[model samples]
Target: MSSKQRFIKSVVATAKADAPAMPWARGARRAAFIAKRSGVEMDKKAA
Candidate 1:
């Protein structure tokens, strides 16, 4: 897969891995993943 695709997959995997332990972190990770995929930078403070 291409680098971009690989990044997306990795982000998803990471979010999944973190979900069970920390719900907030998982949500942040998911938001960040979506932002990254959309070529935007998420506001960390907001998250």
Candidate 2:
């Protein structure tokens, strides 16, 4: 599978296996992952 798909699957698996203590924590994790992925895409485009 593609890296992006793998990453998403891993995230889903983690979410299912371990419940977050707070809803905001899950949101923060998702936001951070998106930010990180976007930064990588930007770098690829810039290159």
Candidate 3:
């Protein structure tokens, strides 16, 4: 179980690391993705 969990985590981490984030965007898409994964509610009013 531990090894499987480690492998999954590593895969996700690697995918994140390989993704492109432009200099102007500063990884905003990645931040939203991580927030969504953690069940954070997006505030449409602010957006």
Alpha-carbon RMSD, candidate 1: 13.6
| TM-scores of the models, in the order given | 0.40, 0.44, 0.37
RMSD of each: 13.6, 15.2, 11.7
lDDT of each: 0.79, 0.69, 0.74
Tens digit per residue, CA lDDT, model 2, 1-47: 99999999999999999976775556545656676887743333323
**Whole-model alpha-carbon lDDT for candidate 2:** 0.69
lDDT of 3 by residue, 1-47 (tens): 69999999999999988977565565556666666899997665433
Q: List the candidate numbers ranked by lDDT, top first.
A: 1, 3, 2
TM-score of 3: 0.37
**What would the C-alpha RMSD of candidate 3 be, to one decimal place?**
11.7
Backbone clashes in each candidate structure, one number apiece?
Answer: 0, 0, 0
Q: Give me candidate 2's TM-score against the actual structure.
A: 0.44
* Residue pairs in clash, model 1: none
The TM-score, computed over Cα atoms with residue i paired to residue i, of candidate 1 is 0.40
